[model samples]
Target: MSAAGPLPLVGRRVLVTGIANEASLALPIAQVLRASGAELVCAGLGPTPYHGALSTAAEQYLGGAREAFESTVREHLGADVPELIADVTLDPSLEDLAETLRLRDLQLDGIVHAVAMDRTIRGGAAKPLLQVTREEFLDCMSASAYSLLALVRVLLRAHVLREGASIVALSYLGAERVMSHPYRNIGVAKAALERLVRELAAELGPTFGMRVNAVRFSPWSRSKAGGAIPGLEEAVAHAASRAPLGNADPASLGCEVVHLLRPGLGVTGEVRHVDGGYHVHG
Candidate 1:
């Protein structure tokens, strides 16, 4: 232990997923985890063999996303940090990631699930729930909700996630309530994500000794996804005004996540609010 005392996550390895760019919430979370002395392995969405025959536009978009993710990771997290491309919506892509980790003999102590996507949200506007199609709904659900279960299942099957590992998923208050902004399809997916956290926590805790939890953060508009939601800026302003402690920043959220990720917390299946008392209002 140094003068500052022993790091809480010293010698632990964590997998941080869904880093789309430098403004991503996962970036701050990963920074906090590393500051606590954890070794990090990062995964970002990119084209995979499973995608199979993407249109030129789709390929270009994916390529740009991957490039941004790579640049952000290299600049902020360090070039040596292991980077893996994964499209959690694809089972084979997830399996490939697990295989790579397994081959490297890495056992993760924690996982940060920061991935969420909604095709129904476009051009800073969200389609009404009634307007959402089955395909759009399922696509949102698969990426934002089911991906958590899929990732954990693949990692567990590969024996890459160690016993007692902690898993934290990023969520929002919209999961449980209608927000001033249109959450629509993503809200439903978030609800499922939170439910999965509880169910997985109960099963994994008793059977595998793993912990699963989620953090609902403030109405942030800095990230790409957050900025794309119509009326989110207004929501952010309203939340800041109403919240007792104003609003929680990314650093605060990061700290909360790292606290949950710490070993032997005896906490699981919790939908924690890191939104500065915003979730308590009527």
Candidate 2:
């Protein structure tokens, strides 16, 4: 089919990282963004032909992952939406990704940094900081915290972000608060991330009119990282009860994010909570 003209996100392109499956929050954001007329380009940790982690197992496990995701997204958004691949963890090189998109005539209107990491140190090793390795803790900070800064850096350096661009990163309640031991480094990383979002928003808003923000979600069993958090079920259930509006849907969260990405949305540098009312509860 011939490519259609620009639609809400028309004339705009978005770089969404960390998409895993259809049920993933990123997928829904992609969906809503597409519906709003935005072109799509996805990136992720490797195991896929697109961008992904370099680890053999990650590649093996994530194999065909990007292709499958592209197929699914295209099927839903129609064949016109574009997609791309790149690994965010592979920092310094991330700038090349923007150039890659430029080759396709896609200028970024927004970026979604949904990437995060926790040392799969479950069980005994998942204990308090004393039980965790220095390397593991640093990895968590690098993956979950610095990755956001890295994304903004690459986009800024590449000039891929259009004026008034929106950057959304995910955080959790555990960052400011706490859940348990296994969730340690991630919480610290998130706390750092929340601060980073504000700083970026302050800097970018003045320089480029770009909006930076983080979305804090309650425990949701959609991603592998989330499922690994022990006592997650209880946490989510408690959150649902505390929420004045009851449970929050991933798709709904995506819709809110879509609105934030648009220019003149008048929202930025804020930590938007998609956790129902759980944060308010306690």
Candidate 3:
């Protein structure tokens, strides 16, 4: 509705996950996608009710993250839209996802996988991954890396996504190199996630005609997840100095993901860096 007709993503059914607030990368992507004419279905791990109903466990599981999550969804997509309870850590049931999509009566055109976590068992706190415990390493990998595979597998099984569906996940430069404060096993997990994206491009491209990729983002404006990091502000300032654009902004990355999700692009199975070219210079 920007006076240029419906956005390119208009009429597309896109599902996005891992949104915690209005500033979250996923929400920005959803906002842009919706503006461009894409219908959206937001999935989150929060315990918000669906259509005025919630399981006892869900109410407890959402813990303290529910209110913010609900408010965020309302801000981005408005109230009264479908928001599903989904945990990327668990293998999502295709039937459940399909049933939810059926309720919306929208064909899946793209998926955004933004789920991630670190139990801090890494013990390194913000230290490098080499110092982390095996449990910490695997836990991060399961939450950040393997979840992409699970999501795509479930969607593929359910035949929910249409051909040319784009799958995107978020990553960071630390996944390939070392940072001063260290982020435990997150770097290794990101590397693994990128690898999986490439492998999935090969495995699913021909079979399902879908594309898989990840965006490597630098530190950005603060969020609850980023605030948990010990020296995030310093990291952002450092990246800004080295970055071509002199800053890392989530909005830019959100726009980039929307571009990848749209049709008429040949990019597939690649890790697109939207970090102000910081990855290249640094």
Candidate 4:
């Protein structure tokens, strides 16, 4: 142990998913896990440094773009942490992810599910729920909500998740209630994700000795997804104005993640709030 005491996540290996850019929320969480003494394996939506990990579909999804993803890892996640290319929507891609980790012997102690996407949430105006196509809605749901199940199952079956491991996913206030702007499709998905967190917690906790939880953060506007949302700026301002401690920052969010990932905690099935008391209001 160090001078003070043992670090919270000493000797733990963590996988952090959903880092799309430097602005991504996952960056801060990954940083915190490192600070807490956990080794990290990062998975991003797009390309990886290893060409063997990219399939044809993954290539298409990336739109042949590499610079942006490359920069995110280099600048934020560092050059040492192995950044894997894993798209939860594709089973084969996930298979490859497990294979890659297996070859490298990356048995994880924790996973941060920080990925969410909604194609219907464009910038011009709010796409009405009625106007949203079935394909659009289901795609949104699959990407944002169901991907958690897929990712976790594959990892588990591949022997990636170790015993006594933990999982944490990012969510928002719009998941359970209406907000100032239209969060329609993705909000619905977030509700499903939170529900999955509870269900997974109950089942996985007993069987695998694992814990699962979700954290609902403040109205953040810096992310690619949040910045795309209409009225997000206004919502951020309003939330900060109304919140007792003001809007929470990414550093605080990272701390909460570390708390959840810390071993020996019986905490699970919880929808923890890191929104600076914004959830308390009507």
Best by TM-score: 1
List pairs with backbone clashes in candidate 1: none
Clashes of each: 0, 11, 3, 0
Runs in model 2 deviating more than 4 A are 1-8, 47-59, 62-79, 120-125, 180-182
The global C-alpha lDDT for each of the candidates, from Candidate 1 onward, is: 0.94, 0.75, 0.76, 0.87
Error of 1 at 253 (Å): 0.8
On TM-score, the stronger of 3 and 4 is 4
Give the clashing residue pairs of candidate 4, or none.
none
Error of model 4, residue 85, in angstroms? 0.6
Candidate closest to the true structure, highest lDDT: 1
Lowest lDDT 10-mer window, candidate 4?
Answer: 46-55
Model 4 agreement with the true structure over 52-88: per-residue lDDT tens digits = 5666787776844345655787787678888787767
Clashes of 3: 3
Q: Write the per-residue lDDT of candidate 1 for residues 101-171, one digit (tens) a residue.
A: 99998889999999999999999778999999999999999999999999999999999999999999999
lDDT of 3 by residue, 1-282 (tens): 468655778667888888887767778777777777778888877542232466677566575465666778987689855677665665534346666776666578898988778766323246454566888778888888998888777776666779889888888877788776556577778889999999999998898788888898878646656666777778889888888887657768778888889876788998888888888764
Displacement of residue 149 (Cα, Å) in model 1 is 0.2
RMSD of each: 1.1, 4.2, 3.9, 3.2
| Candidate 2 local lDDT, residue 166 | 88
Candidate 1 weakest lDDT stretch, 10 residues: 1-10
Per-model TM values vs. the true structure: 0.98, 0.86, 0.87, 0.93
